[model samples]
Target: MNAFQGRVTAALADPTLKTAIDRTTNTARSKRAAAIAAWPEFAQARELGRDMKDHVIANMEYYLTMFEANAVKTGAKIHWARTGQEACEIVVGICKAAKAKSVTRSKSMLGEEIGLPHALEAAGIERVETDLAEHIIQLAGETPSHIIWPALHKTREQVGELFRAHHTDPGELATVEEMVSSARRNLREKFMAADVGISGANFLIADTGAICTVTNEGNAELTTTPPRVHIVTAGIEKLVPSMVEAMTMLRLLVRSATGAELTQYTTFHAGPKQPGDVDGPEEFHIVLVDAGRTTMLAEGLAEMLRCLRCGACMNHCVVYRQIGGHAYGATYPGPMGSVITPSLDGLETSQDLPRACTLNGQCHEVCPVAIPLPTLIRGWRTKAWVQGYEPLHTAWALRIWEFFALRPVLYQLASNLALRIMPLFAKGGWISKMPLAGGWTRYRDMPIPQGGSFLAQYKKRQAAK
Candidate 1:
């Protein structure tokens, strides 16, 4: 078995994983549905968001340059990193130059994408995750499974155990609110003592050179405002034309992500503290990491750039619900991650991701910006097959199927014969096992075909009509 399959097998064996994923994803799915239903102009907003993203992607350099100029005018330094490692190095260098000893960070997928935490640790800087879910995963030394709900896979019991293991408190934590209060009390000290803070940008406005951050917990505000130096790490594709368009996208983002009208705190950092400002960072830096995004834009995969980092697609994904995000073994998970991971990490290393999907199109249906996730996944599968990444057995099977498929008469005859022959092995209208097709029947029983091929059934109905 491949690495993904191996991980999936292990995850499946652990029933608690699926149980946790089911509860969380179900709630998220319901909330998103209700939020979308409540918004009368959601469809129009989705189209506008899609068009705006497409426009920015078509003129990526223009928006990026505009953003850089405006940000520079505000005295905010812009660092361009072509790769994840370079991005990590830039953040590390900034910390070292400022003589930062402790760093507080908000939950940033970009930071995780570049392995920033490890880089900071390697640089001898103590890093504390200010976001509660991020703090939980950080204490456990684990990567985020879900994008929005980072530690959704962990139960409250598991969280209590993690806190008890790390924290000085030996009291039994019974409730989530109590756990939150404990974490808040613990993180407040870290926030005050932090020399620097790092965060992710939800949207970077080219007109004003401001980075938009949306969070429900207000940890992002605490992380950015308390620290002396503030660093924003984000992908180049996050650039928008202005706040007008940013608000439009934000509307779709919040509802699609967490089923809320808006997050509690939506802060924008243009630059360092001004002459009249009271509490703001002395240094403001924005690291625009290309990290394969430019390549994706240059290639035909620019549609994937419209992603808002919302976990809506994954929340409704049946496959993701079954195996959970850890099985994907990437920074992003679910339908979006299936395409993003392979697109960024290369198809050779992540070829199995595209094939893992069921092509149900629920992801495409619920996507805020109307990304054709299944279509993109199909493109990845095609690329993988063309690049000789598919297995020899699969290739042969497809070739044999193609031979009959090209000839309708042969295809129909073969299908009818198989339909007739397969039922001979069925017990009580279900096949428990089959030779050479054990992969399908091993996990679940396949119902015996009652009629003939679809064409035959259609013809019979037409004749009767």
Candidate 2:
């Protein structure tokens, strides 16, 4: 194994990441009732967002074209980046143009997708994450495990301890409020002093060129204001056809993802600080990043773009429950991550990812937009197999299968012979070690041909009928 495999192994070994994944999945599972019980608003929001997402995905090309026009008309400079590296360059150039010394951001996963903070730091500007959870993950030098609540993995006690260790001026660790206050005090200093502010849009409305931001704390407000220049980084798929679509998305977005009637704050900023505005940025920039979306749109993977980042899929995912985000080595993790990341990043960088699942269907059931995750992963598996990414033994097994499958009489004879001999090798109706199947033995048991082959069983049933 190379450094990549070594990194994969190390991330898989990290118990903290696994704990976080479990905490998230468990919370998601238990919160389903609470989320639905507190229905009406949240349910409406989820359905609204889901419908809006589906609508927009169906007409993505039209909406993107419309959004770009409106965004330009609103006096916001628009930069189209086709790749992650291009997005970083676009953002860095904007910061540099404003002569920025430091930048503050409000928890945009797309920023992490493009490694914006690293690029900003590399360009000699300090970029600080202002969201409480994101701030924790950033300070810890880790990628976000959970999407909506980035630091959901860490308990209040853990945060207090982390603050106790890292915060320069702090009080005794007691309540979550105190820890939040400590974070607030520290982040406030950065917000007030920063030259530029960057945020991710929950929804981008084409009708009015609005960037809709939803948040619990007032940090988003401060992060967007108090800076000379502001920028919004978002995937192109985030566009909405109209304000109605945005409102619908917001309705479903809050309820399904975090079970909030309404997020603590929801704001739609149309453009730069208007006249008579007491405090807002003077310059506004929006960078539209495609990364691999354009290509994916043309492929069978387009539906992956329908995701609203609700984090609902990971909540129901078993594979994500066991291993977690860091194990995948991508910005987006869990169910959506499994599909979108590998499609965008390709197999060489993410060969182990699509194989990480057990073909579970929970992700699809809970998805707000109904992405067929298992089918997508299987498609990627087939694609990988064609490219020889699969083990040679697996390839040879497939070849043997094809060989037998092409000859029906020969297959039936071989099948009958195996059925006769299978009982001798079987223990409790399962074969522990199979002759030509390392795949079956690696992680699970293979059931023996208990009664007979499917053909034989079907023939017997037919005869009985």
Candidate 3:
């Protein structure tokens, strides 16, 4: 097996991981359903969100320029990064210029994508993840398993163990409340001591130059407030034209993400502290990272830019439900990852990602922004095949099937013969081990064909008529 297959096998073998993923995802789905049911305008809001995002993506350069102009007017420094490495360098330079020793961070998938934490550590600046889930994963030295739930794969017991091993107190860590309190006590000091704060923006309002952030635990509020220097890192796709459109996106985001009408804290930062302001950052910086987004847009994957990052697609995906996020082994996971990871990371490295899906269309059904995830995934699969990325055996099998499929008489004869012969190897109408399909049969039995093929049954019915 290949590297991707190996990860899938390992994830499948972990029952605990499966249980955690199932429980969390199931709960999220139920909550989302209830929220959607209560909101009669959900469908209309989704359309508006999609239209606004499309408008921004279509005129990305214009909006970005407008945002920078307004943001600079508000006394916020704006920096543009063409790549992930450049983005990291920009953030590191900002910290260095401020002479920052310790930094507190809110959860940013963009930061994780660009390896911001490691960059800060390499520069000898301490980084503290203030988000509860981010803190848990940071303590354990693990990447986030889910986009919204960074430590969704871990159980309460595992978190307690991580705190015991990492936290200074090692206090009683039995219940959820106790663990949360312990984490808060530890992080309170870090927040106070932090010289710089780094955060991700859920939406960047172009007209007003406001950075919109929503968080359930209010960690983002603390992360961005107390620090002397504040840096906001986000992708170019996060731009919305104004507050009205941003609010529309926010409505879709909170409900689809956590099944809440609104997050506990929805904070907006326009710029540095004003003359009369009591408390805020001394300096504010916005780092807009293109990374591979421009390339993706130019190459006809622009619909992906509409992503709100609510993770409803992941929660509803059957394949994602079974394997969880880690099995995909990318920064993002699930249907969205299957489509976008190949584009960002290169198809040669992640060729297996698109093929991991069953194309059940649940992802498309649940997406709040109406992204056609299955179609995008299929596009990646086709691209991979065109680039000769498929294994030799798979190529040969497809070729052989093509040959038979083109010859009607021979195809029918072969199908009839195979149907007659397959049952010989079956016991009690199921084949536990099939020669060519060991991958499927290894995990579950395949039922033998009990009757004639569809074509034959159709022909017989026509004759009767």
- TM-scores vs. true structure, each candidate: 0.96, 0.84, 0.95
User: After best superposition, candidate 1 residue 382: deviation in angstroms?
Assistant: 1.1
Please give, for residues 110-229, the per-residue lDDT of candidate 1 as tens digits.
Answer: 998889999999999999998888999999999999999999889888999999888766355788887888898778789989999999999999999999999999999999998899
Q: For candidate 2, lDDT tens digit of each residue in 7-125?
A: 55665566575675576667666776476676656544555666667677788878888888888777787888999899999889999999999999998888888888899989999
Q: Candidate 2 at 212: error in angstroms? A: 0.9
Which is the leading candidate under lDDT? 1
Per-residue lDDT, model 1, residue 153, is 89
Poorest stretch of ten by lDDT in candidate 3: 434-443
- lDDT of every model, 2 decimals: 0.92, 0.80, 0.91
In terms of TM-score, which candidate is strongest? 1
The runs of at least 3 residues in candidate 1 whose Cα sits more than 4 Å from the true structure, single-residue gaps closed, are 421-432, 441-451
Count of clashes, each model: 0, 3, 0
List the lowest-lDDT window of 10 residues for candidate 1.
165-174
